[model samples]
Target: MRKNPVFQNEVLGAAILQVRSGRARSRTTLAKALGVSPSTVGMYVDRLIAENFLSESGVRQGPMGRPRRLLTTLAGAGWFAGVEFHALRVQAVGVDFSGRQTTAVVRPLPAEVTADSVIKTILLCVAKLTEAMQGPLLAVGLGVPGLVDPQAGIGLHYAFIPDWNQVPVSSLISTRLGVPVILQNNLRAIALAERWFGMGHDLNDYVILGPRSGFGIAMVLHGKLVEGAHHAAGEVGRWPWPLGGGDGTSQELHHVLSAPATWRRLAGVSVREKLPEDLRAALVEFAATDSAEWQAVCADFARVIGCLQLLTDTEVFILHGPLTALGERFCESIIRAARALAPALATAPLKVVPSVLGDDAGALGAASLAMEAWSPA
Candidate 1:
């Protein structure tokens, strides 16, 4: 792809992602990464400077020739928005050029939501958010649960939200808002948030799991995201299981472990809002208690982590979603269970941590996707 003629915007935007990732501080380094000469980088960077996307930070003495001028993004020069809809709720978060969130909104969804309703709610959320934007809105990222074809910007299918099938979410949003858009699975968005803004930023090998709402994973290996065939890499939650049979067949793990579904069943009550920490803590204890159903859930969770450990030597595993509300002790409990049943990999040195972003991870992650769509690396 690099050998082909790259569009000026794509080439420049990719450079911006590199800069934001702290991969290059000077055009010389960016040019090296871009496989172009320093003069060519200067030519394009000057244009970026004119656009207020890049600015001269200072100078760095080059190994040869004159000192190299450092470049940086101007904070708050622009804004991006990310909207995540999952567990029958819609959340939107807006971030400035520096990636700090400036505004956010969350709305509960009705029991029976259709495509049109999802559309209306999303538009309303975006409208409310942009009203507070201090800079131009560059793009929006829409996050949904289940299979997504990012290149096509479509939600291919959703087990929980069947009516959402084949929705061209990106096109609709872009047409309505007059800006670019990116559509992705909510879990992948969470992973990107970790990569760019959260705990996994510095790690090359890590796994992110959200078992509560649904089971999904986003893995970064050697500093690159692992998106399997057709961007459906993280749909492990949908894999069929035969409960302890290990005879090697199972059905959607999400039907039982997803937080909203599981909570309703175990608590014997419906929750209209996010579960309180105390109630969440109680649910944790209940699930950890000695019962076939609860024990099986923990065992299955461990088996899943064990599968990941066996499949790849990921160094860190971060659990997002309701599992986070379970607290660190429970998070570590999941890790311990996995390690106990783990295959004999020479060294599994893995640690499980709770998501620091809390309820905001999804929205912020969506916003991170918007930023990436403009400047993918």
Candidate 2:
């Protein structure tokens, strides 16, 4: 048996993307763009064509040579599914080979946050969306909360669920669905989603801020997602708030900035406001308010953003997850505060905006990851 040449080869995948994105139409140009020899690129291009992932459509007349054949992607070659699941909900989306989403589904998680229940919900969502798919489901990308070892396809730990540690989640899902499955941290998945289809589409450096039940971030620097040596590049939840010069009373940024924190603080202050037990509803209440507590929350959150700007110096900060419900005004406040604190280091402007994909980003990002991780063959 022979292994597939196109499988897991960055150069082969790059060749397909170069042609699909219209960045390179000829083997010569693709070789130049990828910084590889023309013959090397030609080999991959030919293999891609044979695999139905690429097709030569026409020719380009060169100024000093014979006509070069032009290549284009075959959008119907295959499709992918992405799933994002946490303790509360499950979301799934389907996209074609060209990265166009065809269908999506969202469902509340079963009361029990067991691994079995979560995987079952994911399969159901995929099945529901599969009915609307335009091609074969080639792979799946899963966005999971907490620590994930994507290369190993394992869910390392998720504090919210019991017995989620070291679960072979990707393999279990793939075995049930009969397709290759990949895992990504949910927050990181949101960043990838932004890169492919949302706010960070045009920028190479940015951060995805998750201020929902926790305070974490996903950093994309120099056109690549940064997962530290331990795969915890953006796990800032445990970091003490205020970065520096904080009194001994300072708390973890996660507890200070999370929606549950806000609700807990409010509940302690007064009974006039009815705080909802549901986290989503609580977030909505938090978003609609401008009380002293909310203002304090904004100011503290702004300081973190300010510190992030000074440290990372990324072009944009995209707010994802439940915090996005705070709307454009909340982002504007963060932007103003961050700029005031960081000041201008360069001529480029700083941007803090809400995610374009909103709650759907995690799932769609999972799908984008699947698409990015695998090339049609």
Candidate 3:
């Protein structure tokens, strides 16, 4: 197979980014790490600077010669928009070149939000956010809770938002805003955020499980997000099993483990509004008890994790979304149950940790997608 020459540039760019992120190293240090000539490293750095992707800063004085200029990413060169739509709300965040979030807005959406209404709301939010940015917007990224085709910027299917099926979200948004756009599955986006800025950074392989109004999983292998042949690598919630057998596989996982589901399980309880502290406390207490309902939910999650682990060979599993955010104890319980059911194929210690990015993972990941798209090597 003929290897693309640009692949080498991409590798070098990624290496430079890693160094900038990790230690803010010099060109000589980068050359050492990349096993290349200092002059070659200088050429790459110069190109990056000319492209406005990188900048040099304060010099570090060494004992031998002149002060060395530190190379770093040009964070304010452009802005990226990140949007995440959930069943009940839509979140939009703007991130700068240095991966720092500059603005964030959250708004509630009606149960039956129309496509036009959603698009209008997104535009309004973007307009407001861009007004606050330091530079022109370079790209936009949208994360939807469904199967997304990044190449086409379309959503193939979304159980929660039926109207989103086959929606050319990227083209619609980009055309309206006059900027480049990228679309991604919400779970996959979150997984990417975890890999870049959260717990998965140190691990080469891991799984991110989000148990919210829907259940989804994302697998990262060899430090790259693994989207299968059809971009459906992490649809673990749809896996056929006793809980998700037959037509159930077509249903959203949110219907099984969401707050509404828990409220429904408790007779005469309403989950339409934000759960009260007392109600939250009660649910956590019940989960701690050895009740049939709690046991069933925990067992189902454990089963899902076990199945995913066996299939993906991932060493760490991150539990995310509202369910895990309910409390530390609740998350620990789920972790314990999953650990008990895990297979021995995992040679390294398995970590079932909570997501540090919380609900922002999707938005952050979307921003990252925009960065990758706008600044491709």
Best by lDDT: 2
State the TM-score for model 1: 0.84
Error of 1 at 41 (Å): 1.8
In the range 93-192, model 3's lDDT, one tens digit per residue, is 9988777789888777876777766777778878878878888787898887878887888888877766767888888898899988888888878876
Tens digits of per-residue lDDT for model 1 on 1-377? 23444576688887887777777789878998888888888877887788788888777887789997787877667899999997478999988886778999888777887777887888899999989988788889887788888888898887667588899988888899998899888887888889878998778888888775677898878977787887788777777764454555555777656766556555655546455544456567564444555455566677777788778778888888775665676666666777677656335676778878777787888899988877522
Please, what is the whole-model Cα lDDT of each candidate in the order they appear?
0.77, 0.80, 0.72
Regions more than 4 Å wrong, model 2:
1-9, 25-28, 58-70, 242-250, 260-291, 339-349
Residue 326 in model 3: lDDT: 47
Error of 2 at 315 (Å): 1.2
Model 2 residue 48 CA deviation in Å:
2.2
Q: Against the hidden reference, what TM-scores do the models get? A: 0.84, 0.84, 0.83
Off by over 4 Å in 1: 1-5, 58-69, 243-251, 261-297, 343-346, 375-377
Candidate 3: the clashing residue pairs are 213-254, 214-254
Candidate 1, residue 178: lDDT: 94
Residue range 163-252, candidate 2, lDDT tens digits: 798999988998999999999999899888887788676688999898777778999999898888877788888788657846898778
Clashes of 2: 0
* TM-score of model number 2: 0.84
The lDDT of model 2 is 0.80
